[model samples]
Target chain A: MAAAFTAIGGKWKLTLLYWLAHGESHFAGLRRRGAPITPKVLAEQLRELEADGLVERVVTGPVPARVIYRLTPYGATVLPVVEGVRVWGEAHLQRTDGQSVSDTAMSCASSIV
Target chain B: MAAAFTAIGGKWKLTLLYWLAHGESHFAGLRRRGAPITPKVLAEQLRELEADGLVERVVTGPVPARVIYRLTPYGATVLPVVEGVRVWGEAHLQRTDGQSVSDTAMSCASSIV
Candidate 1:
């Protein structure tokens, strides 16, 4: 469980996964979708995800390479988990009027997941 | 999502919740189940969970009060999510022969969830 968490437990990784799961596979697309994460942090997180086999990065073209990221089959397994969290967050927001679990990272969880 | 993660993201929190979800509600029971976590750390994580409304702490008896912990209704919502992660971890263990995602915390995720 903690391994699952360690593999996908960051503030931005799940948000990034949420977007990629929705077909936003390009690096630029992920950056735009993952607004709060600076490029450096995003890059680092992606690297970690790739290492964990949850994400794959592909580069295309001879020049001005177009980098793309997609969830591996293994990575896609997390979709249901993320969806569950999103649903729970929506209900929590409604019940609490968005007052509890005040971490800023949760704001992203609420928005993206 | 991050808030949900932050609320329950630690190495010990979900593991503790997993035991409580299974009816191991007393402090001693949790400590025995959560062997790797020192008593001090377990206390801290439970306190955080209680503060987040995920776990309720109850006191019973007159002197040498017997304290108990159980998931709030809100916390119970996370059970399916934890179950999902557990399934994933089991498959992951089978696939990798238990070599990857080797953090000690993951050991707990694997056992408890």
Candidate 2:
């Protein structure tokens, strides 16, 4: 369980993977998705994901290279867990609607997932 | 997604819930389970879980005050996500056997889960 968390445990890693699942994206594109993750942290998370073999970083072009990230085959294996969390999060939001939700919860609820 | 993470996203919260699922335990009993979590942290995690309504804390005695923790019916709803992470962790360990795994991964893999 720790291994799974180690790979995707960061607050934004799974969210990053979820975005990648929809389609590949450059770092800038990901940053624009609005999770409030700093560039340093985002780079770090993506690097760790790559090292864990769950995400691949592709650099294209000689000048002004575009670095794209996507899930690896091994990384794809974790989609079920990510999807599970997403589904549960959606349910939880409805379940607790009108209840006070923290900024972290609100940000992660609609945008992060 | 963030809501779910906010509820049970602590390093040891889900594991604590998993242990509680098997049976209720006091703070000391949980500390003995061997996760290396400090008393302060364990207490805080349980408190958060309690506040989230996923865990129920019962005071069983007055003089000694045995505090027992267990999963509420709502707490049980998260078992599937926890189980999914566990299964993925187990598979990840097998998939990467003989490969380098960090201390965090090893600790969370066998003992924490």
| Best DockQ among the predictions, by candidate number | 2
Off by over 4 Å in 1: A1-6, A9-12, A25-44, A61-66, A99-113, B1-13, B24-48, B59-68, B99-113
RMSD to true structure for each model, in Å: 5.4, 4.7
Model 2 C-alpha lDDT per residue in residues A2-102, reported as the tens digit of each score? 34445565656667777777777888888876565799988998898898888999988664547789889888888888777767766666676733445
Candidate 2 is graded, for docking, as: acceptable
| Candidate with best TM-score | 2
> Per-residue lDDT for B14-60 in model 1, tens only?
56666677763777767654256688878898998888788999887
The lDDT of model 1 is 0.65
lDDT for position A76 in model 1: 85
TM-score of each: 0.65, 0.75
Estimate, for each residue in B1-113, the C-alpha lDDT of model 2 and write its tens digit: 33444566565666676677677888777877656678887899899888878899998986454778888988889878877776776677667773344554234444322
Cα deviation of B82 in candidate 1 (Å)? 1.5
User: B112, model 2: CA deviation in Å?
Assistant: 14
Best lDDT among the predictions, by candidate number: 2
Residue B52 error, candidate 1, Å: 2.9
